[model samples]
Target chain A: MMTSPDSTGTVPVTALTGLSAFPLTPLKDGQLDQTAFIGLVQRLVAAGVDSITVLGSTGSYMYLDRAERERVIRLAVQHAAGIPVLAGVGAMRTEHVLAHIDDARAAGAAGVLLAPVGYQRLDDDEVFELFRAATGRSELPVVVYDNPSTTHFTFSNQLYGRIAQLPGIISIKIPGVPADPEKARAHVAAIRAVLPEHVGIGVSGDAFGAAGLIAGCDTWFTAVGGTIPVPMLGITRAVQAGEPAKAQALSEDLQPLWELIGQCGSLRVSAAIAERQGLAAPDCLPLPVQGLKPDQRAQLALMLDRLGLASL
Target chain B: MMTSPDSTGTVPVTALTGLSAFPLTPLKDGQLDQTAFIGLVQRLVAAGVDSITVLGSTGSYMYLDRAERERVIRLAVQHAAGIPVLAGVGAMRTEHVLAHIDDARAAGAAGVLLAPVGYQRLDDDEVFELFRAATGRSELPVVVYDNPSTTHFTFSNQLYGRIAQLPGIISIKIPGVPADPEKARAHVAAIRAVLPEHVGIGVSGDAFGAAGLIAGCDTWFTAVGGTIPVPMLGITRAVQAGEPAKAQALSEDLQPLWELIGQCGSLRVSAAIAERQGLAAPDCLPLPVQGLKPDQRAQLALMLDRLGLASL
Candidate 1:
């Protein structure tokens, strides 16, 4: 029900359809390999992804120095080539957020995804303040990101409702609660019902709940979309067009890879997948996160084979 | 009994005693306020702080652009004179850690305080690999910071024992455990018994634990020390010199301020106190973290007045 902010009464719910990949920014010999990054983006776009997120958690935004972030954003914006490039703009402080916004703006990003400030526990008012401050600084449309698993804080329904009223907020990316599908569905429905018709609510958890999200929200943010864009796009398109059987069937095909990834650690598994897809070099996870074990990798490959994504 | 690698004998067990203040890196508009930072360092040193840690969590090292981080490190090193300056060198990836070590070396930091590459959970081997890589990169002594509250993963005692064996790891700063006297004594005994004789164990939590840490560990890392240096330093010195009565008297004067901070939020309250003490600018916390409430501010002032530290 989220409507578009533009004059058009009809919400341009750009089928949050298709694969929305968060491509890993390649680092070679201790520096960002722009060539590898551009090649990766080109492949995603060619594979029929609808949108791409740059500088995501999977992209290791936390490690990138400021200049490197700027360069990465610029490259992503350039290679995205008219497909909306959503730049990640989360930082520990507001000044850094502002700086990132400036970089995103200069890179001509279509919109920015803002993560909550600080990794500490915060009340709703503080969360509102963070979004307000970020929206005030950013000229571009904003997409609020709610990924509680990494951030250690989740947005309450009331907080989401309040944020939906903000002028600059165009969309929200809600990560499906992994432990309970029913609660995730309820959350999506609640957010969708409360948000203005123009605001899009996208679900980010891959195909496991893609059908439910497509049914409840406006768009779906997919991790697999970054590498295997074609089939994901097919699934989303079918879901958006109300072809439930086709969508469900495709999700089944995609479910194996998702399950494989679920078995390993979060970002590490994602990075490993990216590496397998030739989008990145070896998975070079930072400390406190290691690559998957050989058996796990074999399981993942088997799943990839079943999904017809063996090339990845 | 953690003995030094060199013939320093039993690592001096210098009762990691005293108020170790981590002064904020001042900012003017958007840039590093070098003059203000230097002035603050001079004040802390003059106040008789036992040690100064620059580029700490309170110092906003993560938000600092690389050049800014270098500048801050250089400034802290130059201003530190003879005082030990522990440079914060935590990052998401090993490469970034290396970059931080290079900067720390260039700045002539006495030691590096490392936070585990956070935001993900790594197994034991990965943790070992991270420390091994870091130690290989730095020649200066290292202080391992085990702040599970921020890192989301606690360092196992076994891991600490392993890290203690690594070259260059001279100390550790562990927080969030109970701050009770008996508990503190037990923790020190346990860690000291396992760690090499050269490793120094430090305690970080509420200031009430400073005495306990002096009795238990080799050092005490205090957030309060950044604001009220004189009393904390006096208390640590008194405790170290086996003057329990004097230490108790100093603790009585300092206890109220610590309690007031406990009443308010930890980070905000500490930052507010630092601002009041003229160590940092008022209302300078990064986004999502607001300044103290008026009542909290008043209570802080009252505590400072009772301690006779308002003017100092």
Candidate 2:
């Protein structure tokens, strides 16, 4: 499945399962803090995350230019040591996305994640062709991102099936729907039935990762896990060991962070929490994107202490 | 006004006030066709376009990586042969954009054009900060882009006044609303009143460029004009020479190409038209975007013939 274009890097295409960290791409003085980034990736690998997804939602791939994105990917792959690295490759233009795929392969990533990000309203055919063309050219395996809120395009069951059949596509990241559990279950079940046996279903949304994991998703695509990885991994382990009650408790432990994330979105809340914990550098998102209001940070501090995550 | 970072490359920012070509960014097998791009830029300069926008919307600025965008800007500036070259300095991130400004300045560009291109809805404060940050860092003049259809954010009257006052911001690109004639006139007039006298208002929309010129707007931002520069220049010359009817007729000549662009978008239509005109190499916008179907190509050929623009 994940046939690395280079023979030197051989890892299973489905290696990115269980708990994966979409780490915060902390920047210092308007430039990437390479040491901080290397520390974050190495932390995830040491903590035993299934994969390190560099330039994920938490990593702010949209904010980075081509050179910065390539540098981030290379840093993640190099410091990951033996751990698998999945790079994010999303852009408004198809050729730009194709170029990112080529960059990911050249950087020796385990796989590249893609989203059909464009300003224009892309029809089903356009979105499908986007994936078809990207996967057609890429040597690295791809994880299709179905982020309707951001990309404004959902990978429908038919589209998912079509993408699943595309060569080098190994996974689909199904974003969480906290408001409708039944719909989420049905959606995942329908898509799972259509997807090939080898292809995996990853669950995004720190708020709904436990529910998704319980609903038979293969990976917990957590934003909080990227900073405070222990709780996320604890939930993953509980679920893997068939202890739903323990997983439920661990999932409950993340409710405070998830609630804050739900308030202002992960981009701000996660960075604020990381800054408070002293795990990440200041200003993850660009300026004018307020990290967290003073009151919100206070609540987050109290919650972190209560959950024994203040020292993480 | 366009103080190139390198002192050797001095050009007035207002020099880009006439017919300016936003050229097709030709790619051969997914790589930038340097020869074709250089030839296209050289052609525009030779034909006497007031400016050559290296990474305009037609050039697919959103699609190119930092290295490619840099290469394009550098190549255009070098081959511009002392003509002013306005470089597109837009990116989803602030630092990436700031980096692009440095790149454009280092590449010896006359000035840089910017747009609010973020993944999420950037608030008024954020947009202001984005410009303030960019202008504060660069020696080059700035052209604020207000393509709401593409950027999903309109530069309001307040915003126009605010950005117009920022240091190093010499111009603003006001996209013409030809469909709503009354709205277009009032919109431009309102912003013109607020803007500083030093800041020029350039008009985008090839179809409405003549009306914009008549209405006191400065530049004719043309996409089709990049490949067929003569007709666009003829309109500008007519407007400058105080012949409104001639300018109108010259603008009408672009109607057919604009109609095709209205159907499948500029990325498809421009590349197709450019490929047909032999102004660019085949396969400009990656695969599956398609270079005009046979019927569409036939229609385009007829339009080019009817306008007597076949040799342009």
Candidate 3:
């Protein structure tokens, strides 16, 4: 049973079940578009997302300045109201991570999902030291983020086993096998076998294997969920309730949208999907990332239409 | 003849020339190590450096939070006095670049070296758009940084030619071919042929081709120059005066030290050399960077001793 850090002094590690949507941070005239962002958050909340994650790679956190990140987190917290908001706080240095952690706590973040040093490969000791320092700095629970494809360093199963034991670490967010469901299922099983049952394990390859990851782990994080939260949330909940047929049908309805998003690259795809759903502007990326191709946008629109989510 | 932006009632494009050393911004206990940084700048100035470029990729700019970057730039301007300080102002977004440009100008930077987005791959138009936006935002002359190896996006001759006509851009900093003098020579010739003669071209390969690049182009930039400024300044002067024998002799004397510094990766290697020379502390990296290896350190010390820079 997960307990609240505030109430029970041992917050129950809530299973991050259902669609955990990470909304793209909107930018207008070179600054955070808070009004648009808040509206998007409201829409996602209304659509019944299980949790909200801000400042993830999809949210363009790397491109945001520190002050902007703080403001975004604060806005997310306020708009999210009772929904849990997980702030992405990973950086190359432990000190930077600590600073972000402090900001996340002050901003009322429910937890922080940290990406390891993104630039270079870090040794096991350095990685451990980073987590130790981060956990020490923030009272809130931390989610160890391991996306080797993006960060260029995957936390070995051994490292994950060690991190799993660290205090205040409530969960691990692993991106399911790069593109294969079978491999992802195996990875989920391997990670689940080692981690304590109380510590939730969430998979980030949202639409690809939301059902499988839900079957294997405790939660499913989806970029698409940020736009069409209801369907994804319904699918995950159904899968968890042992309604595999209903879950499969719902997932089928969501697959085209997910595949279309997967085509634009991670960050851009997320942002593009958000824009198509009226969650963000089309040109919301930092440098190095261009907007989606017209054909991709058309495909997304068609997918939304097929799912009867075009209006929302 | 390079003219000031204020000249002719139009922004005069001043070509940033000579070895523009981007010295490491030192930190102690999570705060800016102003004393150490200023001392390093003083050494660079006393050694007759043509210009001081702070917060480049070699300086770990990405790891620094915005406030830290601004603070470092402000301190650099204050300490640099008459020597022109070119602050590096590059990011993944146009606004971030604009903000850096504003900060650099406010800090009294002589110019801004704009690094293209380092993380993602951008097409020609996007790259051009980034430079265009930066140049448009800055009152000070902008140097189009073309270190593709680090940015992961090399500027083609066509792309360079397109942006070469921009109003504020006046130079390009090209890293010399690694361990290949012929390639270095070819790069210089090719870049120079396309870039206007008035637009300065600077090379960064430390001691290896400092003279060759100077012999081939108008100027050379050195990571080593920020620490052992006297020797680098001597070599630059010799090259400028067309004294190949003197320049070659100085280059030969400094070759081993440069090679040793080169052994460690750029950021850590530069920091290590700076610390060994008593310029900065060894642990001052912003975050996400590891220190030099034992063998690398010993090799550096040996080279310093052989070059009579052991006192450093």
Task: Please name the candidate that would achieve the greatest lDDT relative to the true structure.
Answer: 2
lDDT tens digits, residues B1-312, model 3? Answer: 234532112222376655677788777766688899888888887777888888887666766767778887877777775677887887766777888888777767778888775444467888888888888885688888777545667788778778877877778776665446566678668777887766777777675555455447666767767766777777778877877678878888766766665555566666777777767776776654566767888877777777788674
A71-183, model 2: which lDDT tens digit per residue?
98888878886678888998777877888888888887788889888765576777888888888885678889888767766667888888888887888898884445567
Per-candidate interface DockQ score: 0.51, 0.30, 0.37
> Per-candidate TM vs. native?
0.88, 0.84, 0.86
Q: Is candidate 1 or 2 superior in TM-score?
A: 1
User: Going through the candidates in order, what fraction of the true interface contacts does each contain?
Assistant: 0.65, 0.39, 0.44
**How well is each residue in B126-179 modelled by candidate 2, as lDDT tens digits?**
899889988998668888988876777867888899988998888888887554
Best by TM-score: 1
Kindly list the interface RMSD, in angstroms, of each predicted candidate in the order they appear.
2.6, 2.8, 2.9
Q: What is the lDDT of residue B210 in candidate 2?
A: 84
* Candidate 1: tens digits of C-alpha lDDT, residues A206-292: 745465554566666766566556676777778778886787788777666667656664466666666676666765444445678
Regions of candidate 1 where Cα sits further than 4 Å from its true position: A1-19, A117-126, A177-185, A211-215, A252-255, A284-290, B1-19, B28-30, B176-180, B243-256, B263-266
Per-candidate Cα lDDT values, in order, are 0.70, 0.79, 0.72
lDDT accuracy of residue A6 in candidate 1: 25
The candidate with the higher lDDT, 2 or 3, is 2
Candidate with top DockQ is 1
Question: Could you tell me the lDDT of residue A92 within candidate 1?
Answer: 72
